[model samples]
Target: MDTSLDDLDHDYAASIADRAMRAMAEQRIPPTPTNFAVWFQYFAGSHDDLRNAIDLLIDHNRPFDARINQDLFETYVAPQVSAVVVDTSERLHELMGTAKDFLATAIADNHSQIQAISDVAGQGQAGVDPKALVAQLMNELARAASRATRLEAGFAEKTRELDVIRDSLSKSEQRARTDTLTGLANRRALDEFLRKAQTTAEWGEPLSVLLLDIDHFKTFNDNFGHGVGDQVLRLMAKVLREKVREQDLSARYGGEELIAVLPDTDLAACTEIAERIRRAIAEAKITRRSTGEVLPGITVSIGVARYRVGETVTDLIERCDRALYLAKGGGRNRVVTENELDRAEAAG
Candidate 1:
């Protein structure tokens, strides 16, 4: 067999093994005898072929160390893998420390060599036969200088490349998370905010969500047409962005619905903010193009719900939805609080 062809085959096999390992880790499968046997059977083939493929993959993906693999496996596969991963990680850390010390020593030596060269050049005395000593020093200095220069250049180049990559990634991420039409965060972004809010609530910070729906938006679309409707939506989004705090998130949650996530905000503050937004929407003057006819005013009904310490994202959303329904039922263009509903029911 051709050597290059064999190498390609080996690489392909290794990639397959790596994918399988990743799958097992993600699934949190333990490497117990039974589990291992099942996994092996699932990826059935000649034992030698499988082993060779795995070995090739391991070699190619040198960063996939035992510690990382084991940690992932523990998180996804089995609890026992945690201890092994921890031990391996500790060992790797120790090795890294030793390597760093070695590098530091080498850098110090190079610095000392450069210093000696400078000292010799500065000395005015020419009587002493410093030829042999000077020659040896010069050779050592040249080697160290060349190595240092190359290392610095390589580091700078890598830094520049990384910065370009980071900027590109940031733009891509912003595009993915933003709503193109309204300039607000999209549904996907809202989901991410909800996840983070849940974490914040767990850490004893208050979280609140406000769901706002433009009252009778479909009627506006039907009367004014979609082009004008889109402009109205954009205007609403602008008002929301201005009204919400820096730490808060405002997103277009599909169609005429929008959501705001307030971290470290209580129910009262959220209600006030929602009311302000509602007022802003009602006061905005939206005009039509063809006949110079100004459309009727717009209004939003808002539902406010605060984090109930141990509530899940879904639970919080449902409560807010219920409040929103009540707001719409009671009247359009008003804010409703979940706590208010509880109080009303109690009084009734």
Candidate 2:
């Protein structure tokens, strides 16, 4: 025996082989020489190697353990382990060839027998021997057929489980990227959008960003309470989404502040979109659905900045934020551009 084989725990192999044989017997499969050969092969080989060999043998209609055990030992094991290695090698080769021929013949015979039985069964004759009928059924359908069915069912179940897992993960991802209060994209989502927008801008596709803040928001919260203030915020988000193009992204940037990312858009287009959003908010009649109490109207001060070549997403956002500050300083309901910032800086 090879040193590796010797090192292997034979007891474990023997136990497994024994259990396998017992299972076969319980299934009423006759313990033939071929079956013993297969069992011996499984016991002597590594688990993975044994499994592969068994699968091949089963496909070839030579799955009986005795047949595998006898063939494997004669063809591979005996030669490697025997004291008279030369003689063992010659004998192993001869026996292996003989086993191959024997298996081919057995398979042909079994096929012929099955065909004959199937023809007889198809005739629908009465008074056929029940045991013979059962044997025919087992040979034709029961053996290995049930295993295939089980494997298919197991695969389908696993597929369903994977789909469910994927759906749960998708929902979790959405929650992580969204603001809970306004049901809009949050800062995390905005950062991702900005990074993508920056890449597009580098590719010669202009990108624009808008930063807008609700005017006098603190006073609304103070006078009408936080609940009404929240209602106003939600309504504003709805209007922003409704007004912005499908390609644009709207996000809530902390309290009373929002941001929009517009891909392939210039400063003028972004300003127009911002104005539309502003007009929508000014015209919207947002009252407490629960209380029917009219809430104070709101307006947004917006800053529009086109992404400059070689500028980072952070730089564009900061410039837009500064422009928004300027808009607030100027009036509170107007749109300010980065050009205005340049003019202001030059004047200063």
TM-score of each: 0.57, 0.61
**Candidate 1's residue-wise lDDT over 1-348, tens digit each?**
111224447666566556655655654443333234323423434344434544564578644332443333223334333454465556556655655665686688778877877766655264445786677567877877787776667556655655665576567668666766688997678888889878878988888989998899878776766568778888999999999999899998756778899999989999999999999999988887677788899999999999887778889988898888889988878999999767766777
Model 2, residue 282: C-alpha shift (Å): 1.0
- State candidate 1's TM-score: 0.57
Q: After superposition, how far is residue 143 of candidate 1 from its true place, in Å?
A: 6.0
Model 2 Cα shift for residue 21 (angstroms): 69
RMSD of each: 14.8, 26.5
What are the runs in model 1 whose C-alpha is more than 4 Å off?
1-147, 202-205, 287-293, 340-348
Tell me the lDDT of candidate 2.
0.72
**Candidate lDDT values, in order:** 0.72, 0.72
Tens digit per residue, CA lDDT, model 2, 203-245: 8998998888899987887687656777788888898888788
